[model samples]
Target: MIDKIAWLHLVDGRILSTRSRGKDVYYLPGGKREAGETDAQTLVREVREELTVTIELSSIEPAGVFEAQADGKAAGIVVRMTCFTAEYTGTLAASSEIDELAWLGYADRDRVSAVDKLIFDHLHEAGQLS
Candidate 1:
């Protein structure tokens, strides 16, 4: 299966997350890739479109890759989340299809998806989350 990767920014000890317009759960502020787009390109474009901020491509560093059952999809659906922590410019505002923005901690994992739970686990294990 093809993996979906995203660059997630952790700021001030909180991870940046978003919710879709009609969705109740929060998700990491990134999206799926387009054909022919490199991982860096996909990350930059997805983050910009969702958060209305320009992430410095050079500043982004690989955090981890997480996999889990895809949310609201078929049984075999799996997502590969390529995460990153980066410095960005511009105010973080909800743009495009994002309805709200949130800074979530490990305690908020229950409110996220299975894939995001794996991300939280990685962050906690790596001492990035408290």
Candidate 2:
């Protein structure tokens, strides 16, 4: 299993997502947690690296945990995504491995990875997403 962290940045009922360089699908902003890092620390650093915006650590909150088959990977390989919502600083701009940025609603499920689709569904069900 591959474990990851994700930021649930919702704006106007849409969520912020990123497409990494060479990847076809978009994903929730954030990445793998480094060894010895707390989830908040991982989120702050990963969001800064991927979105060029620093997540306000104190504002971070647990959104949900999701898992799915890893896209384009070996059978049985799964990605466990721990998600969060938080305030952040700086304008969002793609950086590092990120190649594209998008604000997605529930209608955009087909555009993201499986675990991200689950997040969208959850947010939509809670009326926090479109």
Candidate 3:
């Protein structure tokens, strides 16, 4: 399995998502951990790298964990995504590696990766997403 950490930023019932350069699908704004990194560390680093924002470490909260077939990978490969919600500082802009930034709602589910679809569903069911 591939392990990843994701930042779940919700605004007006939409979630923050990103699409890396040359990638077709959008994804939640976070990424894989570097060696010896904690989830919080990885989250802060990834969000900063992808979204040009600083995640407030003390504001980090467990959102949920989700698993699904890794998009564009071999059929049997899966991804285990540990997610978090946190307050942040700075403007939310797509960084160099990112091609686009979007605030996606439940209706935009098909635009995201497999695991993000699950996140969208969860948020929608919880009435946190429209």
Candidate 4:
């Protein structure tokens, strides 16, 4: 199983998230890996396209890894999401393929993916949620 990683930003106690067009659930603002792309490369490009920001990769800190059943896939098709927190530049706005951008709190967990729910749980347990 290939694990995908992304850098997430928590600003003013709100977690950054995005939703693709016609998608019901909000997701962490990131994307999948391109062929032969490194984790950092995938993260950098995905965040830029989804959130319109430049992630300071050097400032990235591992947060947690989450696993869940892949959406629209059969059982055992799991998605491994390795999460990170980092400092970044530029004002965040929905861009490229993102249809909506949001800042969600713990109470909004049900609106996100299963893996993201784990992320919120971890953040909440660690007193990181605002």
Best by TM-score: 3
> Which ranges in model 2 have alpha carbons more than 4 Å from their true place?
none
Q: Could you give candidate 2's per-residue lDDT for residues 12-52 as a string of tens digits? A: 99998899999999988888989899999999999999888
Count clashing residue pairs per candidate.
Answer: 0, 0, 0, 0
lDDT score, candidate 4, position 19: 90
Q: Rank the candidates by TM-score, best first.
A: 3, 2, 1, 4
Q: Can you list the residue pairs that collide in candidate 1?
A: none
Question: Could you estimate the TM-score for every candidate?
Answer: 0.93, 0.96, 0.98, 0.92
What is the Cα-based lDDT of residue 7 in candidate 3?
91
lDDT of each: 0.84, 0.90, 0.94, 0.83
Question: Model 4: residues >4 Å from true position, as ranges?
Answer: none
RMSD score of candidate 3 (Å): 0.6
Error of 1 at 69 (Å): 0.5
**Candidate 2 TM-score, true structure as reference:** 0.96
lDDT of 1: 0.84
